[model samples]
Target: MSKSESAVLDTRESKELKTPTDLARKGVVEIAEELKHLLADTFVLYIKTKNFHWHMSGPHFRDYHLLLDEHADQIFEITDEIAERARKIGETTLHSIADIAHFQRLKDNSEAFVAPKDMLSELHSDNMQLVKFMRETHEITSKHNDVATTSLLENWIDQAERRAWFLFETLRAH
Candidate 1:
């Protein structure tokens, strides 16, 4: 190669790669883009959970805060894996908080004094909504035979469902 061509190549992080799996490149790209949207929603949910965790108060402060903290950590764990999945499929992943905000379907709560029950109810609803999104994304992964992602999503779905379940029981009337 010529000197000019060599310098141009050096500027790149990595060369374009040929995906080794039988999965179609076009389909992988499509799936990864959708995953980006999922990642955004996940981020929003994580932040909301953490917000509730930090602001928790009243009689059940200890239990509620700990629950939210655990669930928030679980939600945060999914973000990096989803972003890496996008990269592994040769697609660009989300870059900034603005990018996540743009794609996130969940609402952010910045109020100073939401009731504990209200917080639980909101997070319960959001976790269930996430289960819906995860199921939809699973369809794409299943269609493309992305076994690794599909398997990981199964675990995530269960975690989200469990969070919703716990919150639902917590919010029940006597």
Candidate 2:
């Protein structure tokens, strides 16, 4: 697409939503904010998981690397879904690490080579945090009668919790 075309499209969409947009029902504003933060958190988590996958060492390297890769993909998918949800609610999705870093609740790993156990711990923490956030998002959406977003949040919470439990158990078993 041409740059001008894209700009015009963006402007048109913004204009369309400028007229008293729907407030996501039942305090969905809170849910949207939580999802935005969660998306940002997931973005950081996604990059961290990929980094761990690349730098993982030790005896269970193969297993840990593969698991990290899969987890990273899952985190990316969730981030995309959350961004789409933000768009649905008449909010623009935040782009770039800088934007995410400013608003994300997740921690950044700057100059540390994380051990396998530490990687697992980090993923576990993020997963659990997102699950908690999603649960609250789901509750708010349910109250607002947004069954679709509520259902999606419920499923996401379940999956993230499962992934966290698996990682925790793996570390414990070793």
Tell me the tens digit of each residue's lDDT in model 2 across 1-174: 999678658868777642123564435566667677778878888887888889899999999989888888877887778887767765666777677987788787764678889888988888888787777778777777767678888878888888898899989987
Tell me how many residue pairs clash in candidate 1: 0
Worst 10 residues of 2 by lDDT: 17-26
**lDDT (Cα) of model 1:** 0.88
**How do the residues 75-168 of candidate 1 rate in per-residue lDDT, one tens digit apiece?**
9998999888887766778889999988898889999899999999999999999999999999999988888889989999999999999999
TM-score winner: 1
Q: Give the C-alpha miss distance for residue 37 in model 2, angstroms.
A: 0.7
The deviation in Å at residue 15 for candidate 2 is 3.8
Segments of candidate 2 deviating more than 4 angstroms: 1-28
Question: TM-score of each candidate?
Answer: 0.87, 0.82
- Report residue 6 deviation for candidate 2 (angstroms): 21
- List candidate 1 segments past 4 Å from native: 1-21
Best by lDDT: 1
